[model samples]
Target: MTRITVLGGTGYAGRNIVRVAAERGHTVTAYSRNEPASPVEGVEYRTGDVQDPEVIRAAVTGTDVVVSAVSPRGELEGTGKLRGIERRVAEEAARAGVRFGVVGGAGSLFVSEGGPRVADTPEFPDAIKPEAAELAAVLEDLQSSAAELDWFYVSPAGGFGEWAPGEATGTYRTGGDVLLVDESGESQISGADFADAVVSEIEHSEHRRERFTVAY
Candidate 1:
């Protein structure tokens, strides 16, 4: 079984991943700012601050993969701070010979080949621009600054997150940075299916050191 560590383990994506990985018989440890309301069975939950490098190192050191599902909200606000957390975790994972996998945003994805990123789309809203832009910077930094690390940034389709809260079909489609849409022309994936894709990739190692997306 792969020993996996998840940062922001109580958050939506992290919590789901922790549950999925644990259910699949992987050794899972969850690190977040607070304990989860309903912690997953057979999983170790660790409460800590991502800003502390020592805390991050402790979480990732002996794990086979570190899934960074941290979102820039609450105590983790600010783009620079978010970037710092990603960097610290990536550095620690690299030093410890662990893979660094990120739960990335669709904003960094491309609409067409050699085209503008989703964040730069004219139709993109200005309200959520700050968070989207920060994620875009995270992707850029991961490819440039943390290039030496074995990393995979998994970006969900456009209609992901708590707003939708769709149910899983035990199925999902994979794609590169280009946006993916279903037969109904919708860009979405259930949280459960997203977690399945992640753990499946972890087991199979199909996409290595690159960014990929998941959708219905």
Candidate 2:
């Protein structure tokens, strides 16, 4: 079984991933600012700030994979904190020769020819823009970094997260940068299904060193 450390394990997406990973019999260490209110069984919970590399490194030690689900709230100024944290995690994962996976935003995903990113679209909420931009920047940096890190940036389907909770059908579609939509022209997936995609990636090496998205 793979030993996985999930940063931001208490958040919505992170918690789902942790639960699914644990259920799959993978050992999980859930690192967050606070313990989960209802911690998943079989998960080892640890409390710490996401920006601390030493803490992250300690948590990552001996782990087979590092899944960064850390969310950068928009109120936080600049991308320094988020970038620093991701860079450090990538660096440490490289040093430890471990695989890395990131929960990236759909902001960087293209919608159409010459159209703006999902985050830049008028339909996208303004409240999430800052965090989306920060995530995009971090992905860009990770792509350009010198470290030979085998990192996968997993972007959710459009209308993802708590705001758009699609029903879990135990089946979903995966795509690269292009958006995936159902026959109804809707792009979404349940939290559990998204977690399923992440765990599938963990088990299989598809989308290595690149980004992929999930949808109904």
Candidate 3:
């Protein structure tokens, strides 16, 4: 079983990942600003703010993988603040010699080959622009990280998270930078299935230091 540490373990995405990882028999640790109301069984939970690097670094120490699922929304909304946060995590991952996998946003993905990022589209909703823009930079930094970092960024299908939590079908389609869509042209994946894809990559690095997306 792999020892994995999940930052933002209490958030919508992090909770699902923690649950799926634990169910798969991986040694999982959930770290967040506060303990979960109902912690997943067989998973260790650590309470601390991600704003503090020491707390995150200590969590990264002695772990095979670090899953960064931190959300830059709500109280920390609409800011390009996660760049520093992700850099700090990258720093610790490099120091501890652990593989890093992050649950990235869909905004950074290209709508076309050259450089038409999703965030650049006129139709892209204004509500999520801040979070998307912030996390997009996080993905950019990961892509250009040092060769020995052993990191990967996985962006979920557009209809992800608590607002549109779909049921797990135990199936998902994976693709690179360009968004993945079903025959119906809907870009979505269940939270559980998204976690499954992330863990599958963690077990075997398919897109090392690169970004991939998942959809139905």
After superposition on all C-alphas, the RMSD of every candidate to the true structure, in Å, is 1.3, 1.7, 1.3
lDDT per residue (tens digit) for residues 45-113 in model 1: 999998888898798878899999998777777767788889888888878788889998888888878
> Residue-wise lDDT of candidate 2 within 84-193, one digit each (tens)?
78888998988888899999888888786576788888888887788889988988887887657989999998778887766668898899877777888888888999
Candidate 1 vs. truth: CA RMSD? 1.3
Candidate 2 lDDT for residue 135? 89
lDDT of each: 0.87, 0.86, 0.87
The better-scoring model by lDDT among 1 and 2 is 1
List the pairs of residues colliding in candidate 3.
Answer: none
What lDDT score is found at residue 216 in candidate 3? 93
TM-score of 2: 0.93
Roughly what TM-score does model 1 have, to 2 decimal places?
0.95
Candidate 3 to truth, TM: 0.95
Supply every candidate's count of residue pairs whose N, Cα or C atoms clash at under 3 angstroms: 0, 0, 0
Tens-digit lDDT track of model 3 for 32-62 = 8888998999999999877787887788898
